[model samples]
Target: MASLNILMAQINTLVGDFEGNTDKVVACVQRAVQSHPSPVVVFPELTLSGYPPEDLLLRPSIELRVAQSLARLCAELPAEAWAIVGYPRTRDDGLYNVAGVIHGGEIVAEYSKQSLPNYQVFDEKRYFKPGSLPCVIDIEGVQVGLSVCEDIWEPGPTLATARAGAQLLINLNSSPYHRGKRGERWQLVAARATEAGIPIVYVNQVGGQDELVFDGGSFAVTAGGDIAAAAPNFEEGDFWLQYDSDHAQAPFSGLQVYPPLEEIEAVWRALVLGVRDYVNKNRFQGVVLGLSGGVDSALTLAVAVDALGPERVEAVMMPFRYTSQMSVEDAAEQSDILGVSHKVISIEPIYEAFMASLEEEFAGTEVDTTEENLQARCRGVLLMSISNKKGYLVLTTGNKSEMAVGYSTLYGDMAGGFDVLKDVPKTLVFDLCRYRNTLGPCIPQRVIDRPPSAELAPDQKDEDSLPPYEVLDQILEMYIERDMSAEAIIATGMDRQQVQKVLRLVDINEYKRRQAPIGVRITKRGFGRDRRYPITSGWRIGD
Candidate 1:
């Protein structure tokens, strides 16, 4: 019947900003101590120096700084308050993604992460060695369990802690956001609580880190499988959850509730936050992109303007001879509708310049895709020039379907500091454009209804080189994202030759995706961290 007050700080942290993260952690603990009676404040995993530090963890100096910051935080903790903080831990062998329990000005208990995720964007296996021990800490007369991010995804870690006589399970997480992930986490946490016969507290990191966007939907589930308390998603806030064993009969916590966003809305918010944080945190003045009269660029521009504001977005329309007048007019109309600065840059001169330079080499050959690619590359050069001259970052606008099939040029539209839709499928790109227009007509309707084209060659359409997006995206979702074998994809009632051809395109385009700019991930498996394929492999999928 005893009650323990636990405060969860759903914080947004900048990656590699050790000092800022430490300062925020200190402030949260201080607030928790002052607002409640000897509260235990918990933060997300690796929150001391931010999550997924990438190669920054490889730098020894960064590790030293992280350790010193932890020490400084421990020194600043109040005598009555308990703080469970996450950071990097170093041993004789290497480093670890570790959590430290600080009480009375020292680390009372430390737990290193047992599960090191090596797949996707996570390279923890390459950086830190796993710890084998389960850490159990006493929090205000209650036996509390401790596990890092990936440990709770599997059952053994939670089951182990329950067997070790822990009454309450506390997991610190830095789980990233993808479509429908909140529901999935709720299901996973509820299952864990039911199996262990104990209450569970799950805290996830918030905000964007590079291409990864962390949606902070931290919550608590009771032993009987009910959401005892839940934090707001996608923002920073501190809330206290009072857990009373007797009050398990009545699940009334009337905390501030925010309904979950729809799948499309969630994906849109994640993309906006990812672009906002990546551009702002990296210290770019603004963003510039080629506003091709296509859904990919149109959606990219809408998301960028939404994230960074219209004034911060600059769209350049680089038209080629093959580009239709309707395409040109719609590009300008969309820019005007969005209230962003627009420029008309003709790539004809640059294309002519490149052709003249290569005239001798092309003396006997008829003009082909090589000439078309030159036009795309010409636009890329001009976009980069604007980016370099104005201190703005160039945002590439290619989508997942094109990127997967190598439908894009290497240095053409592919040139940029970051790509906004590199992982978004072509179907989702259209969906997003429709979603944006529903908010208000930010994009021209003509742009949406028109056939998609690269416009590098005369009257070219995407269907000329690739399958229809409806068909192509379905095959891609099966083969690329879901990891379904080509035969399994073919069983989905698709053309056998078409399925094989799309798979081949995906395999061959690995080299192009390798050099692609980091883009926001909307699917369960994105090209960013989750999808890592060999660039030069001889593997074939289907018959």
Candidate 2:
């Protein structure tokens, strides 16, 4: 009848907010103790400092802050419970990402993360000195092993811990979200559990941090690679699982694993969570995005309202000569439906004024993208003004497709503090718009049905300048995300001309993307921190 209660502390943490994050830890431990006796509570990696603390780890105060917080936890926590939480441990050699076990108001055991992920949005190697040993401690007559985020990804630490006489294993994580990542985690963890023959419990952080969003799809798996329990994705809460020695074959019992989020649904939640945390964490009063009648803006507006609510979101429609009457109507309609504050400020006068002022400088240049860019700049100015005055964040609506090919104008449409769809491609933007419609009446149906245009030029269709989004997005995914070369992509049956054009655009547009705002990253490689390319490069567009 020997059994243990495990509480998964899937909580959101603000990076560098030691006091606040510690408060959450203390509260969670207290809450778990009240309900379950001698509960084994596990928190995500870097629980006190938050994940990807980035350069904040370099500051001298990091050691002080972590020590203070750890001391507070030891003093405040109940003596009976065993709480395993992640924090950066400083040693004479260097700093290490360690999961420390707190029992009876003191850290009884510690295990530093062995695998420091350095690629693609992670730079842990720059900060942490990897640990070589596995830590297994006795908890309530049961032996448990400990590891941090990246340790579970590799076989070394898991196998090493299992060999150390551990009957159970606990891994902490601050794993970020990308489409299809959850499935990858499930498969990988199941393999580890089956190989080690030790039932494992995984806990992950939930919430957004800058371009990164932790989905928190924590779970437990049996030694035979079967799922025993799972926490929901893109949420923050404490979920419990029971481990009984008597039922070794199916020891986990308190919670059952449910179906994970579908890919599209998970992406939508990632966007919402990313936007919400970016705004709230930065302490912005609210968010204001340009609600052009275009699909991109329409989708961005819907996400904003859903993330921050109608009261905290404001939509401004700035129209130019090319801006259609239908565009105006649809923007107003959606805004009305969403109950967000909507304002229409015609940019015609602003455009005219800019043109008039630049008349002398633009002596004999034939009209081109410059004029179209001026229109976008006009709207950018209006939005930035509102943002500045009202203390609201200006959310740009440029999609990844436009961002990939430099279709946006710098200091024009790209002028903003944040871009919600910065990582979402145009094709997916429409899908999300349609998806939002399915949830409720937020985006207008016509907005989803209509052809996407910048409305910068009369009779402008995005396809007129660039290829159709369906083709463009596919190529972009191959080139940017998959890192496929133009020839490789063309050999895969894509049109050579379109592939060349897209690759060329993507390569040359690094300057523009460098200046673009940070947004949610839902793909394996987003334009932000996920994909890093130099603005200045002599590299050609070939393999």
Candidate 3:
């Protein structure tokens, strides 16, 4: 049996950054050639322009630039080495998410994606034409089967490739990270490799792209359904594997390693990377947010400081007349500890102006929730004003639990360039605050212990407007994520009236979510793309 050395460079690449992505691929190939005896190196799917170009793939100019970039990458390839990369291939049928195998400055083999995932943060079918055949290439007396990301998730694609006389399967993946995805990926792909009796290598992309964070838990499994070698998740590195015919497959030793089982820390890291990359890739100077001395803004600021450094992150304390002195002190202390630039811009005068403007219609109301909402909008206007003046992107600090229950004010706190915790729930928000403190008390301890409040009105607590987060998050998980009916939610030993009330708020808040900016996702069901509900939905009834 012959031996083959394969190098998988799980490098971080940005979306739509053609020059950067191309340069990355070229550098990786050079490193691969110098470091290992492998003649072939594999990259994550869409390595030339990053994964899920979204609607950017639709632009003809982008496609042309991608093609030119690929040509440039080919021009720099060494004579003895082969590069297998993923890119977009255009044809009469439309565009295809393709994998190109380039050897000697020419594309030797190209395979289009067979299964385009359209569910759960994916819209590939809308943009890509499916490929019907398998692509195989021979290198160093070894037959390599080629398939894209989703193709490996399904069984038939892998089997079809193996049956077409391929000895080894190499899958290029840009699989996004969700909770417990690595275990699931290993289970399915290992099962597929066992069934087909072929060794499988999975390479995933690393780094953050908008709401999506691709954890490069790339790995290789043997034909007997055992993990062989794996890469580290949430980081970038070059992973190598040596395969020999006579050696028995050791029981899958180096399968991917996750964070120290600290799930909230993982969430925090993902958020930091997401914010850092999104801002850095989009060419923003820095980040600005309305710091109301709440856990949500506090956590967002911590994440921003860790992600882009405190030098690039700015926090503005937008205090209203009702904003408490404790809120101010806690926020200021947090800013001081995090060592980021801080500013105090009171929104009381602006809030008074809005109330005066609406004095005619709100005369009989005697200053209600409308007044609270006005304070938020005033803060929003001020944050945006600063954003426009300094060219810094405003980061909204609303969490998923608030957004889910419509407890947030639209065109107000929901207004920002990017939302850091839009997909994180209230429970997770508390957990993250606790986690941040464990890392040497970055967040003020009082900020984590104090009851959550919007502080838009005097003596206002989150419970005043909504149910307890413990009960509320449970009810929400059942109804929103699990698709439980209101009756079903009540069956879980929850109060019927509370269930009905929470359901109503979630139903009415669809319009607010529709108007919200895109936020970092950390849950199974998030507001942005994963969870879709109609604004006109009337699917609930009073319990």
Compare the candidates by lDDT and give the number of the best one.
2
Worst 10 contiguous positions by lDDT, candidate 3: 251-260
**Candidate 2 or 1, higher TM-score:** 2
138-199, model 3: which lDDT tens digit per residue?
Answer: 87777889999999878899999999987788999998877667778899999999888888
Model 1 poorest 10 in a row by lDDT: 248-257
Runs of candidate 1 exceeding 4 Å displacement: 92-94, 249-257
Backbone Cα, N, C clashes tallied per candidate: 3, 0, 1
Cα lDDT tens digits, model 2, 359-447, are 99998889999999888888888989999999999999998999999999999999999899998998898888888888988887888
lDDT of 3: 0.84
Provide the TM-score for each candidate, comma-separated.
Answer: 0.95, 0.99, 0.95
- Candidate that beats the other on lDDT, 2 or 3, i.e. the better one: 2
C-alpha lDDT values of all predictions: 0.85, 0.92, 0.84
Give per-model CA RMSD.
2.0, 0.9, 2.1
